[model samples]
Target: MPTVRVTRYVTPLREGGSLPGVVEAEDLGTYVCKFRGAGQGPRVLVAEVIVAGLARLLEIPTPDQVVLDVDPEIARYEADEEVQDLLNASAGLNLGIDFLPGAFGYDPISEPARDLAGRVLWLDALTANVDRSWRNPNLLVWRGVLYAIDHGASLYFHHSWPGGTGDPVRFAAQPYDASEHILRGYAAEARDQDVVLGKRLDDDALRSVLAEVCDDWLEPVPGAEDADALRERYVAFLRARLDGDRGWLPGEGAA
Candidate 1:
């Protein structure tokens, strides 16, 4: 919603064995820049910008984030070649995310899996993030609720946009059926003021939020394929969920 400027480029942090640069944002506070090497890899910053911003609009619990212009001259950390190679080989070339010093870390939820169903459904339906599984523990439990992080791996099926028409992913538009676990979990947290959870998305809100956050980035990166195909796929996915039939609470929402 507000213009973000990258300022005070901080040293990089090694997470998942890659060097991700951290920068202080004059308006948004802090951000982690996933470095892009010469080789090919999914653009983590673009994913963050689209997914995190959209997640916020969908009322999902995501860490506040923004895209940052990186300064190679100011880069204070040297990446370990072996680690970089490994991440490059396994996770591809982009550097991992740079988080802030006070960013809170928490244990995963310990209750029945049902509590996380709504979250999983939201991640699947909207961001289409593939990382937040029970095994990966990408969802962090702080205080008493869940917060989502590490979305560097989603929308990978379509890497680049194709001249703006966009890729069509049928799953994007399908209604994400709430599992019994999701229904119970959302109901349990319905009264919890501190918890930021995803209620089912309606079509208009879903499209509006996606356009607001990702429309600009839908263009292809230089030297990369047009990103419009991917953008279309993402939009279609959101549309399917909104238009499809799904059970949702009356007024639960997040930002």
Candidate 2:
């Protein structure tokens, strides 16, 4: 990911639990910055990087991500106590998604293409993402294009890790519920996409995607030992899910 120094904190986006912010960077670009020190911690950033890479590989539209270098001094000038506190704690590298000006939240009125929706559903199911329901689509519509965002809620298995990674086979066996998914109706189509997209996630492709994750974000876990080990765990988990039974695919005996 490209690195950029945050020059200004534009405003706080309080719609979500973590309270990500819109800010300006050294490259004269605006971004929605996800703080590493947020309540969910760097693990959420790890999900963001990994999923974003997967999205790109599957031809999903998403904003460009950057490694935002935040200065501690910016916190001192923040007027809001809550915002200031967050800035103070996030005085280092944070995750930044290039902000799209005038983007509107996605609604059912303007549905995306069937193939696009299927690919999205496939990606979410593959990652065991539990956050793309109708209640919180986590999608943005900019210039009539649908863009996926806020994947911090996916890959729930990582949250259970005390010092090591979770069981890949267990995650692979877990069934995904598409009843409330934004693209729930496209489950059948997604299954077709599953066959095609699944084949694309070979070792080299997964490695390229995993390479985008920052080492700092891969916090050391007990059995994992270090960031590289942790990354390998993630790769293994994903590969297991891909190569394991396709029962997790929506409409394929999935809930």
lDDT of 1 at 12: 48
Per-model CA lDDT versus the true structure: 0.47, 0.89
What's the CA error at residue 96 for candidate 2, in Å? 0.4
Residues 158-182, candidate 2, lDDT per residue (tens digit)?
9988756767999888888888888
What's the TM-score of each model vs. the native? 0.58, 0.97
Model 2 RMSD vs true structure: 1.4
Q: Report model 1's TM-score to 2 decimal places.
A: 0.58
In terms of TM-score, which candidate is strongest? 2
Q: Return the clash pairs for model 2, or none.
A: 163-221, 163-222
Question: Candidate 1 on 1-255: residue-level lDDT in tens?
Answer: 444555555554554443555666656476665545422333454565556655555455766654444344333343545433433332212222335354455443455344344544455444446554434555555545556676766655346443343433344343323232223345434334213533434445445555544333454643334445444455665555444443333124321
